[model samples]
Target: MSIPSLLSRRAALLAGAFAVAGLSRPGLALGAARANPVPLPSADQIRQDYQQMVDFGPRLPGNANHVKFVDWMKREFVAAGLRLGPCESYAYRRWEPKRWSLDIIDGDQRHAVPTVAYFVRSQPTGPQGVTGPLVYAGRLNPDGPASLPDFPKGSILLFDAELPKMHLRQIVHPHFIHVRGETDADVLDSLYHRLWTMPSFQMDDLAARGVAGVAIIINASSAMIAGNFSPHASPYKPKVPALFIGQDAGDTLRAAAKAGRAAHLTLDAQWVEGDVPQLTAVLPGESEEVMIVDTHTDGQNFIEENGCIALLQLARHFASLPAGQRLRRSIVFAGWPGHMSGDMPEAPGWALAHPDLMKRAAAAFTIEHLGASEWADVPGKGYAATGHNEYMNWPATAGPLNDFVIDGIKRHDLLRHAVEQGPGYTTGRVFHNSGIPHVACIAGPNYLLGIVPNGHMDKLDADLASRQTAMIAEIIKQADRTPMADLKGSDSSLGADPIAGTDSSKRTQCQAS
Candidate 1:
């Protein structure tokens, strides 16, 4: 769940009554049409893919492992009978954090602390590192430096990274009528836009104020660390170093700041440019209409590797189908290069880059964060341990598919272990904005910024993963049979405007989960 220092983007399933589509659709009534039964996703196969991805080590962008993972994905798609376009090659700068350390120095007392490396395109901080007095700055929003009181320019700027509480209420205007906007594309966009801007807005303002360096206290659930920043999207080079420390270290640093103490921080990192791969594949169906399936292929560990496996499993299932039994809508599988290419114009995400192709898509599905172990925020112990799949949705339409998904979970008897309809983010933004119906299956808690590493591969629940994969497959099957017209009105305001002609260029650049 880490972002590149520059471009940072923060970062299901059911079973079903066999041989039946959603109750909403009567055309495909039970026993009326015997469509080939969609093969259920296999837990064993998912486990094998997960293990294989882990064996490649962290798939950091531009690294050999990252390239190898890309190659592996290409091979897998081909083996599954999917066809790919020439791999979209993109070049960008990345950071390599070789070593680093942080400590609070108060007169005669020195306190050592652990650090979560954050990427920034700045000059190297040699072995000696930088030392400066620490200044405490409270929560800073996108409004910029104006939100803060006067502070020492040369001192290190410290802040807490916590998103404010969300109070969602319907927005009504005094003069204009407020239509039912819950499922509006603009609503989702606005919500995500705020999220995607928080880190950058804060960082840019601090940099503008000319702070010597920056440090954040980990303030979320899970003792995990998040370090994702994208240098590719930032137009200005970082003038200061930045890093994150855990809750305990944050408490120590806060104490030091309150006592007017100086701190010594060493950042051992460098910036280098190299090639990273982005992949797109197509499995043509019987009709001219299409459906897009996408997922980011880069991350710290299992946070997103689980997703990659889910995508692979879906590919295998579809490919196994005979031509006559294949989906009625064309399926496009995209393994996008995360943070490496940034997003949009500077580095267009797959959906944005292929506007013409996406225009043909009746719907888009983004698969992400499958099988993360369940965790709870303890009253005093931070995050407590448990186990199960996390299902969050931001569906852009209401139809039989949603009902089928919920019903499938129940039929499989996994409802108690699942959390449905929680707030989630995905590449669904692209299709949603394009006036196409968007659906996403996001599992796991650590999918967000404060992501902690799963317990060395055992925390992921393979059986749960199987259920989520099966659930998504069912949704796709429903969408294939359901007419595109029915899903279009989930948000009617966003008429069928091609994404290329819309304001997608203005959207935030993110390595969506």
Candidate 2:
């Protein structure tokens, strides 16, 4: 069957599912008479959209799955009655690993060590691989001296790095309001923020030291380690092959290194140069100014890049409205790629590329990592849910944008959420930095960067996601009615920094690290 036909069948199935779930109520259709306010997409519809994106698998930039998802996103936008805008394309280097393995050779005995994942953008070894004497480097201290012990040339270095123990309370900004379920005891023990920090810096140092390969002993469970593409920033691409060895195998690997054994490391990968596409579609309103609704298309799992689905749902809601009820400002739905790979341009670059759109933009809204349930690795048990939604952050520019986000949270009963200052870690930070008023909702779940089993479909809360998306929809409506001068308040009137207690700048590095 053709793609459109298949999509039609899927839509029918979804509609049937919604009816069975009692969500296909009256006044939801585009032309239906309304007793209530404009209806947002049902939780079931959001889940179906999210599931379709997850089904596309890991959407690393320039990869086949990423391209397929971008195509689907464009088709969905068109189906929602939005007209397509010119898509911006840029060149980027794509990496794909074929096969990789590590073996410790001690005298006559050779022991294989299980690897969780390869460091993305790490150098690849040939078919013969690289065999060299193992060198054991101690645990890395981020604040410690920036020096390493000398090792023989072409040696495979083994090092340990502890994933920082974090709690939801510790990371919440000072301006957080209506905080819920976050206590000092709530441990966020997964590698959520560690994906880009010390690992990449360590890799860069090792590569500079002429190491043939590196084995990193990540102090986390095998499940957490699995599919973790560390050192994911654009900079700090390691020239030496590297692999993540889980803590379970750390003892054996450490022993081998101590015994002065030889280790063989192989990371067979290929690099392809391709074009990364950033898509934009517009829903015309009564006015020329546009509210840029944005989200990245590239990510590892369901929660990581599911914002595009939410964006789509928002588009559907606004587009379904009657011509008489349209907002004052147009809606520009933007889908960005390369959030995961970092090889392609991000929001800042996109803004520079689309000067005309940026010139007309009145405000911006971004949504990502929606409806994530809190999960952590228990000492005795494995990774499991904590019976609470992941703590979410709404960082909006100080003004009507900030007010709208807080008001929406209260009105929607969006539990376990905090509202902070503008330009937090959301992909839409570029707008806030560019003086375009913005508000964004994002959660830093442990599995957001992990692929496959790590960021599985079960981690999402469809109801919560729908509610969050609904709140965003309302915020957009409120922004539409507010005047541009009121939305963009002066810096002097913008009160104390909402991120006063926290290092908002460091948070950006946490994403780019």
Instruction: Please report, in order, the local distance difference test score of every candidate based on alpha carbons.
Output: 0.56, 0.71
Top-scoring candidate (TM-score): 2
lDDT of 1 at 417: 29
Error of 2 at 236 (Å): 1.3
Which ten residues in a row are the worst by lDDT in model 2?
504-513
By lDDT, the best candidate is 2
Q: Tell me the tens digit of each residue's lDDT in model 2 across 1-513.
A: 212333333234433432332223111222222345346867787778788888888888878888888888887777676656456666777888888889999788877875567878878997778999998887654442255677899999887877665544455455445433344234233323322223453456666668899887877766766776665655556778988887888888888888889999989999898777777777655555778989888888888788888888887777777656767676778887777775555776666655566666789888888988877776677877877788788888887888888788888887777777766656777787776888888887666677775347888888998888888888888999988888888644232322112111110110000
- For all predicted structures, in order, the TM-scores are 0.72, 0.82
Q: What is candidate 1's local distance difference test score? A: 0.56
User: Can you write out model 1's per-residue Cα lDDT over 144-246, one digit (the tens) per residue?
Assistant: 3445656777677777765333312221111111122234344333322112112443465566776767776645432444443323234444566767565
